[model samples]
Target chain A: MRRLWIGLTYAVFALLIVVPLVKIATGSLEDGVSGLLDALLRPEALHALMMTGIIVVFVTLINTVFGVMLAIYLVRAAWLHPRIKGLLNSIVDLPYAVSPVIGGLMIVLLVGPDTALGALLEGAGIKIVYALPGMVIATLFVTFPLMVREVMPVLQEIGSQQEEAATMLGAYSWYTFWKVTWPSIRWGVIYGVVLTVARTLGEFGAVLVVSGNIMNLTQTATTLVYQDVENFNVVAANGVALVLAAFSVGLLLLMEWAKKRKEVH
Target chain B: MHIEVKGLSKSFGDFKAVQDVSFGIKKGHLIGLLGPSGGGKTSILRMLAGLEAPTAGDILFHGKRVNDLPPQERGIGFVFQNYALFKHMTVFENVAFGLKVKKLPKDAIRERVQSLIELTGLKGFEHRYPAQLSGGQRQRVAFARALAPEPQLLLLDEPFAAIDAKIRSELRTWLKEMIERVGITSIFVTHDQDEAIEVADEIMIISKGRLEQKGTPWEIYKNPETQFVAEFIGESTTVDNVAALHGFEEAAAWTGTRGLIRPEYIEIGKPGEITLASATMRGVVRHIHFRGSEWMVELEIGDIRLITYRSLEKDVLKPGDPVDILIHRAYLFNESDSWIMENKLKVDPMPVII
Candidate 1:
C-alpha cells in the first residue's frame, strides 16, 4: 500500500511538471529547426538573454557576499539580542512570503524619486527606479534568502568547536575561518549560489515592474517571453522560454550534483 | 615545566563549577586530576589549556604568568575527552596540522608528522580518516596531534573514557609509558581510581568542585583526607563507635565519634583485649565472592552490613557462619570526621645485605 501511494504521488508530480514541458518541446519542434534557431538567436532575443544574465550575475554576486557574512554573524556574534536576531532572520525570509510584484513595489517606495534617499541620488543624476539598478535591487530582494538559508544550517551544525580547535592550534580567527570553517561549508555555499542564480534568471514579476520592461535594455528573457506571447509571436516566445527553462534546469542539475557530492563525501 | 594555579575560580551564571582551586604541579610529573562527573576537573583543565579564563585568580607556567594568553600562545597541548580529531583529515594530516599552523617548511612538517605517526603506532593507518579508526586509535591520534607541537605541558581530559573497558587498561599503561618516554609534564583527568593509581605520579581527588585530597595514589588510597575521598578511592567499611577500639583513645578524644577502616586491612577470627573492646558485634557471612587471588565476603554484623577481603587459601566461610571481625589498621578522624591520622605498619622492610 505504501509503495502504491508513493508511485501514485510520483506519477502525479511527473504529470504536473513534465507534461507542459513535453508540450512546449513538441510545439517548438513543429517549427523547423533552423526557424526555431533563427527565432531564438534574434537580436531582441539576444538582448533579453544578456539582460537576464546580467541581473542573475548581479544578484548572485551580491547575495553570496552578504549572505555568507550574515550567516557567519548570526552564528558567531553575541552582541545581537535574541529578539533582534529573530527580527533579522525573519526579515531575510520576507521576500519568500511577499509577492515578487509586492517586493518590487516596496523597493520602489523606498528608493523611488519621492523618497529622501532616492531624491538625493536622483539629484546626483543617478537614476534607480524603472532602471537597471532598480531591476537589480528587485532581483536581489527576491533571491536574498536563498544563500543565507542554505548556508546558515550548515554553519550551525559545524558549530564553534572546530573553530575553537583551530584557534587553539595557533590559527588566528581569520586563519581558522580560512582553513577550517570555509572548507566545511564551501559546497553548501556553491549550492546556494546556483539556486540564487536560477531564481534571479527566472524572476519576471518583480523585474518587470521595477524596470518597466524596457526593450533591448531592461527586458529580461522572462519579460520578453511575456511580450512575445502577448504579441502572438508564439514561436519566438517559446524559443526564448525554452532557453530560460534550459538554464534553470542546468542550475537545478548543478545544485543536485553539488548536493550529491556533499552527501557522498 | 612547573604549573602553579592560584585560587582559580569559575562560575556559570549562578552555579560555581570550580571555586578557589589552587594547586601546584611539579615539573616532569604525571598528575591525575581525579573526580566524578561535574566535580570541575574538566573546567580546571580547560583553564590550564587557556580554553577558558578563570573568573578569579591566576595561572603561572614555569614561574611566568599566562592567565590571559590564548590557548595556542600558551604553549600547552590539550587532548579533549572525545579525542576531537578532524573527521575529514587523515591521521598524518591531523598530526601535521599544528606544524603547518606554525608555518614550518613542508619537509619539516612531513618529517615531524611521520615521526609522530610512528611514535603513536599509527604508521600503517597514517592515511586513514578519524572516522575510519576505532576509539583507541582515535585517542592515539589525538595524543599524537597534541604532542606534535612539542609543547612544554600536555593536558589530557579523560582520554581513555571513550575506549572499551578492555582497551582502556592497555591504553592507560601505554599512555603512562608514552608520557615517561617523552618526559613532558602532563596532567590527565579521570574519575576511575584504578586508572589514577596505574598512571598518575600524583592524584588530586576532587569533590563538589573542590580539591578533597592531593597525594600519591598509595597515600590517597591508604590515607584519604576526607570520608568522600576515602569512599571515592577504594572499598572501605565504617565502624560505628570506633572510639572504643585499641589505640583509638586519642582519635576518640579528638573526634568524639567513630572511625572508618579499609576492607583490605581488616582481619577475621582474631582480636586482642583492646581490639576486642571495639568489637561491638559478631557477624554472619551473607555471601562469598572469589576474586582471583582473594575472597570478598559480605558479612551481616547484626543490623549493619560490611565487606572484607581474605586470602583465597584462608579458611572458607559460608553463608550463616559466625565470625569475629577486627579493625587492624584503621584511619582516625577529628570531630568533623576529616581524616586526622593513620595507623602505621609495624613490620620492618627486609634488609638487602648483598
Candidate 2:
C-alpha cells in the first residue's frame, strides 16, 4: 500500500514538473546541434550572454555583502525599536511581491533623464536609465531580498551566545564574528548566492525595461530570446532558451548540494 | 587575580535586573552565585566577564579599574550553560582559537593546545567536532578552550544545568577538581542548592536582583542572614505572627515578625510529659514520606503545616496520630525582613496560656 502511494505521488510530480521541463528541452533542440551552436556563438548572442554574466556577478558581490550586513543588524541591533525592526523585516519581503516591471518603472521615475537627481547624475557624466547602470540597478532591486531572507532565519536560530562566548575568550568583536558567527551562517550565504545568481540570470522584464534591449549593447540572454522570437527566428530563440534552461537545472542541483552540506555541518 | 565589583547595577528600560550589588573575590577561590531563576545571577556573571556593561558601577581587577575595558582586554574566560562549543571546529581547533588570536608562536600554540586537550581528558577526541561529543564531553571542551588562554578570572553560567542528572553530580566533582588545578579565580551561577553547596568554596546568594548574603557553604547553609536566604539555602518553614500562632498574646511585641524554623530542629514526642522541650505545640500527623535514609513527617496545627525529618532507625509515625511538637531553636525576623537576633533561639513553653 505504501509503495502504491509513493508511486502515485511520484507520477503526479513527474506529470507536473518533469513533463513540462522535457517538452521545453526538446522544443529548444528541434534544430540540429550545430545550428544551435551557430546561434549561441553569434556575436549578438555571445554579447547578450556575457552581459547577463556581468550583471549577475556585480549583483551577487554587492548584495552578498550588503544583504548579510542587513540581516545581522536586523537580528543583533538591540537599540532598534521593535516596531522599526518589524517594519524593516517586512520591507525585505517587498521585492518578492512587487512586479519586476513595476520595480524597473520605479527606478526610472527616480533616476530618469527628466528628474532632478537624474539631471545631476547626467551632469556628472553618468547615464542611468537606458544604460548598463540602470540594468544592474533593476536586477539588484529584484534579488536583494533573496540573500537576506535566507540568512536571517539561520542567524536567528544560532543566536548570539556563540559570539558572546568568543568575546569572553579574549577575542575582538571582529575576530569573534569571523571565527564564530561566520561558520554558522556560511551555508545560508551560499544558498542565498545561488538563488541570487539564478534569479539574475533569468531576469527579463525589469532588465528589458531598463536596458531598452538595444541589440548587443545591453540586451541579455532573456532579452535576446525575446528579440529572436520577435524577428520570427524560432531556432535561434530556442537555442538561448535551452542554455538558460540548462543553467537553471544546474542551479537547482547546486541548491540541493548546499542543503545537504548545511545538514552535515 | 582577585576581583571586585562596586555598586554594579544593570537596567533594561523600565526593569532593573541587577541592583547596586557589590562583592569581592579572593584570588583562586571558586565561588558560586546561588539564586532562583531571574535573580540576576547571570547578569552579574556577564558584567564580570565584560559581556554585559553595567548601567552604574565599577569593576576592578586586582585593584585596577577595568570598567571601561572590552571583553578581550579584560582577559576573562566564560563557559556557557549549553557549553557553546564551536559546532564547526574540531576540539583541537576550538582550544587553539584564543592562542591563534593572541598570535602565539605556532609551535607553542600546538604544545599548549595538545596539553590542554590531554588535561581535559579529551585526548583521542581532539579530531571530533562538538556535535559528535556527549554533553559531558562538550562541557569539558568548553572548559579547556576557555582555560587555554590562561585567563586571569573565569566565569561559568550554570555549567552543569544541561547535563543528565546522573552525570551532573559526577561532572560537579570533576569541575571542582579542574578549577583547583587551574588555580584561576572562578565564579559559577546555579539555582541548585546542592550543586552550589558541593562545588563552591564560598556561596553568594541573591534574590530578585539584590545580594542577600555572602559566606562559606557551611555558614550560608547553617546561618543564612536573611529570611530569603534562610529558606532558599535549605528546607525551612516560616510562621507569620508567631505570638498569634502559639496563642501567646502577652508576647504581642513579636506580632509582625516571622519565626523561621528548620525541619531538623522540630521533633515529635509524647503529649503529657515535657522534657528538654523549649517550645511545644499539639498537631496531628498528616503524612509520612520516605526520603532516602530518613522519613519526613508532616504535621498540621490549626492552619500551619510543618515538616520534620526523622531518622529511619526511629519508630515510624503514621497519619492522624496526635503528637506534641518540639522546636529547639528558631530565627526571628522583623517587619523590615532583617534578622532580629535578640528574639532568636528562644521559645517559651505554652503553660496552658490559651
Candidate 3:
C-alpha cells in the first residue's frame, strides 16, 4: 500500500510536467509531421530562431567571462571581508527569487526612462528596454548563477597548490594560470557554458516582459511560443516548444558526455 | 653552493613556528635537519628555498642575500613530503616539466630529462604515471624532477616517510650515494634519528623551533648537548643517584651535574678492592631481550631499574639471575646532572670510539 501511494504521488508529479509536453508534441504532429517542420522553416519562425540563438550566444559569452573572473577572484582573494563576499555571492541568486515580471519591472524602473542612469544611457543612443540589449540583459540576469555555481566548486577543489607549484617552476602568474590552472578546470568551465547556453535559449518570463514581445524585431522563440498559445495556435506553439526542448536536451547530453570523458581520462 | 641563514623567523598569527633560527651549510655537504614533529625544520627549509618569507632575517647564497628572491629565481630544488608528482603527467613529462618551464632547447630538455631519469633509476618506467608506481618509485620520479633543473641546493622534506621500513632503508642507502655522487648541497628533514645518522655529513637537531645541537652523527650520539638531544639521538639508560666518588670530582665540576654510564661502558667483572662501590643492593632480573648480536638485560637494581647489553659470545643472562655489574667507564657530571667527561679508569678510548 505504501509503494502504491508513493508511485501514485510520483506519477502525478511526473504527469503534471510531462502531459503538457506530450500534448504539445502530439498536437504539432497531428496535421502530418511535415507541417510542423515547414512551420519551423518559415521565414518568420526562422528569424525568431536566429534571434534566440544570438541571445543565447551573447548572454553565454558575457556570463562566461564574468563568472570565471568572479570564481577566481573569490578563491584567490581570501583577504576580502567575509561579509562582503557573502553579500556578493547571495546577490548572484537574486534573480531566482524575484518574479520574472518583478525583475523586468525593476530593470525598467532603473534603466527604462525615469532613472538618471537610464536617461544617461538613453542620451548616449543606447536603447536598453524593449530592444535586443534589453533581451540580453534579462537573459544575463537569469543565467548568471549557472556558470558561477559550476565553476566555483571546481576552483575550490583544485585549490592554490598547483598554481603555487607553477609559480615556483618559474612561470609568471598568467602563464601558470593558462598552462596549469586552466587545464584542470577546462571541462568545468565548458559545462558551465553549456548550462548558460541552455538557460539563455529557454529563458521566457523575464525576456517576455523586457523585450515587449516585438514581432520580427525582438520576439524570441519563447516569447513567440507564448504569443502562439495566447492566439490559440496550439500547433505552432507546440512546434516552437519542441525545438527549445530538443536544444536543451542536446546541450545537457553534451555536458554529460564531457563529464564522462573527464572521468575516463 | 654554500647557504647561510641568519635570524630567520616565521609566525602564524599569534604563534611563532620558527624563531631566530640561524645556521649555515658547507658547499656540497648532505645535511640532515633532524627534529621531532612540529620542530619547524620544514619551515626553515622553505625559507631558504624562498617559498616562504621570513618575518625578520636574511638568507645568503654564496655571500649574496636572497631574501627577496622567488623560489624559481633562488635556484633551489624542493621535494615535498608526499613527493608532489604531477598526477596528470607521465614520468618523462614530469621530469621534463622544469626544463620546459625554463624554455630550454628541445634536444637539451630531452637529454637532461633522460639523464635525470637514468640517474634516479627510473629508465624503464618513463611512460608510467605517478599513481601507477610504488611509493619508492614515485619518490625516485620526484627526485628526478627536482634534480632535472640542476638546482644549487636540494631540499627534501621527509623524503622516505611514505615508504615501508625495508624499502625506506634501501632507498636511503641509494639516495645517500646518489646525492654524494652529484655533490649538490642537500638538506633533508626527518624525525627519524637513525636516518639522520646514516645519511647526513652533519645533523642539525631542532627542538621546538630552535636549534638544539649541530654536529656530526657520531659526535651527536656519543656527546649530546641537551637532555632532549640525549634522549632523541639514541637508546640510553638513565640512572639516578649512583653515589658520587672523590676521584670523579674534577670531571663532575666540568659537567656541573651528576654522572651517567652508557650501557656498553658498564662491564661485568669479579669484585675487586679498587671497585668504587660493591654491587651489594640487587634485585631480581626483570627481562632479557635478544637484540640480534647482543642481549639487552634489564635488572631491578635496588629501587631503580637499569638496562645494559651483554655480548652474544658471553653466557646469555636470563631473567631471575643475580649478576655482578661494574661501571668500567662512566660519564661524570656536576650537581646539575649534565653529561661531563668520561671517567676513564685507565681503559683505552679506542674501543668506545669505534
lDDT of each: 0.83, 0.87, 0.80
Sliding window of 10 residues with minimal summed lDDT for model 2 chain B? B340-349
Model 3 achieves a DockQ score of 0.40
Q: lDDT by residue for model 3 over B127-159, one digit each (tens)?
A: 998889999999899888888888888899999
TM-score for every candidate vs. truth? 0.87, 0.93, 0.84
Tens digits of lDDT, candidate 1, A1-265? 9999999999998899888777667666668888689888888899889988888888888999999999999877756877899899889898999999999988889888889999999999998987889999999989999999988998888777667666667778878777788888888899999989988888988988888888887888999989999999888888887887788788888989999866654
User: Per-residue alpha-carbon lDDT of model 2 for A8-37, expressed as tens digits?
Assistant: 999999999888678766666677788888
Off by over 4 Å in 3: A1-20, A37-48, A73-112, A127-141, A152-162, A205-219, B237-284, B290-294, B318-320, B323-338, B341-354
**Could you tell which candidate, 1 or 3, scores higher by DockQ?**
1
B64-130 in candidate 1: lDDT tens per residue?
8999788879887788888878767888888988888999999999999898889989889999998
User: How well is each residue in B297-345 modelled by candidate 2, as lDDT tens digits?
Assistant: 8888887888888778766778988888866556667756555332222
Q: Which window of 10 residues has the lowest lDDT sum in candidate 1 chain B? A: B340-349
Note each model's CA RMSD in angstroms: 4.8, 3.4, 4.8
Q: Which residue ranges in model 1 land beyond 4 Å of their true spot?
A: A1-11, A42-44, A76-95, A125-127, A156-159, B237-261, B270-280, B290-293, B329-337, B340-354
Cα lDDT tens digits, model 3, A1-265, are 9999999999998798778778878888877788898768777788899999999889988999999889888767656777788888888888888877777777877788678988999899998988888889888888888888877888788667556655556667777777777877788888889888988887888888888888888899998888888989878888988999888779989989878755553
TM-score of chain B of 2: 0.92
Please report the candidate that would top TM-score against the real structure. Answer: 2
- The predicted structure with the larger lDDT, 1 or 2, is 2
